[model samples]
Target: MTAPILEIRNLSKAFGPIQALNNVSLIIPRASLTIIAGPDGSGKSTLLKCLLGLVRADAGQIYLKGQLTDKNFEQIRSISAYMSERFSLYPDLTVEENLDFYACIQMVPKDRKDDLKHRLLERTGLESFRFRLAANLSGGLKQKLALATALLSSPEILFLDEPTPGIDPTSRLEFFRLLEELKKEGRTIILTTPYLDEAEKGDEIVFFHRGKIIKQGSLSDLKNQFPLLVFSFEPETNIFEAYTELSKLVGPENLILRGRQLKIFVPEGEELIWRGKLLRLKREEPRLEDIYFYFERRSEMMELGHDQ
Candidate 1:
């Protein structure tokens, strides 16, 4: 593995008596798209703030690109671009005007500004609407504009918080296309999102919960860790009622209903494994969502002293 682009060591922070980050430590492999996956209030946003030096840590050290010094703090700050969840765009400003305004703030050179702005607009599918006011843009377009502004300075690292929480399906796909382009250019990215379905899009995932990292690995590894024998069924009866009836036998934790299909978690020692066959199951595959819940349950069980 190449030297870490962002190295966090013993990083801890608190808000009065509430510990936001608990001795959190991790490394962002250079050029890798690392995602800090967790539910809301999981400290993902707080962790990002600490990395940007926007929030001071009570204890710990951060190193950017193998160098660590207070003198280089300002330099390190300039090398990365950070985008928050609620992207701020001037409602009255045209798409092009917003980009130009951000470029000026980032100190983008006059000679290079036109080309950069045009290219970003074209790549983000905003070229046709370049003259449209931001307020008139859709939720997706606003996000793309935010990303475009972040890239205006061409920073090496991009830290984004839940870039696609409430976005439409089409917009989410488009944002990922832009992410793929950035990934190909060897850019380091760290983003936080609650959507487990998006896990496959990242090179590595940091599964976080309650300010703690419960799991860290690639999507495949996480899926493999899911302890369940999945089962799908399409019955002639009420599907929800079937789920409720089966819940008594296999347990509610074992059943996950997705539209017309269901994924049942067969405990290692439970008798539900054979019941799945007797009950007539279909499409059998462990998806990322299943794996996500599996880990979440495991963490909860661990917390509840189910395992020591």
Candidate 2:
């Protein structure tokens, strides 16, 4: 892995009675797609905000290119682009006009601004709709425009917060295609996403829960680290009865019902207990969803055990 471009040491934050982030630490390698994956209020957004200086951390330090830094992130901001959760575009402005507005803000040289804008419009497939008003554009187009504006400065590190939700599937696929192209150009991309299925695209994933990081690693590495063996089979009897019976044996946390098929994860040697009752039983590879749930369940159980 390349040397770290962004590093956080013991970061923390709070909002009134809620602890938004707690002693969180992370390392983002240069030119890698690092995903922050978590549910709502899991501190994913807060961590991003802190890095961009939108929200101040109550404690901890942020380092840029291995250099310790103060709260003022102006230096970091100079080399970074951030596309927030909300589409921050001027509804009254045309697509071209919005690009012009952001170009001025990013201080792109007048000599190169027009050429860069033209290329960005073509790249994002917005050239034909350049004259269209922002309010009139579709959700997907608005997101594309937002991305175009963020690239106005040609930032080294791009931070995106849940950019895929609410968009159509085709648009979502296209957006990721664009992201893949960006990654090829050696630009570091950090994004927070709730969609674990699409997370395979990332070089590394940081899973967060309840204001803490549950686990962080590459998909294959995390799967290899998983302790359970996954299995699936079709039950000869009613699926509901099978589900209930299995739930009683191994708990619902270890079981997933897909139509007539039941999938489960159990410790070594435990599969023998239910093997005789199952029909067409097959061993299965652990999926990202299964791995995430395993870590999440373990974290919850540990917390419960600690509280007692």
Model 1 scores worst on lDDT over the 10 consecutive residues at 267-276
Best by lDDT: 2
- Cα lDDT tens digits, model 1, 1-308, are 45688888878888887778888888888788888888888889999988887888888888887666342367666888888888778999999999999999989999999999999998888999999999999999999999998999998999988899778999999898888889889888998998887767888988887677777888887767666677676656788887887778776667777798667777554444333456656546787767676677667767777656
lDDT of 2 by residue, 231-299 (tens): 886887888988998878887678788878888888877644554553345888998877777788778
Poorest lDDT segment (10 consecutive residues) of candidate 2: 271-280
Clashing pairs in 1: none
Global fold similarity of model 1 (TM-score): 0.82
The 0-to-1 C-alpha lDDT of every candidate, in the order given, reads: 0.82, 0.88
Model 2 alpha-carbon miss at residue 31, Å: 0.7
Q: After superposition, how far is residue 91 of candidate 1 from its true place, in Å?
A: 1.9
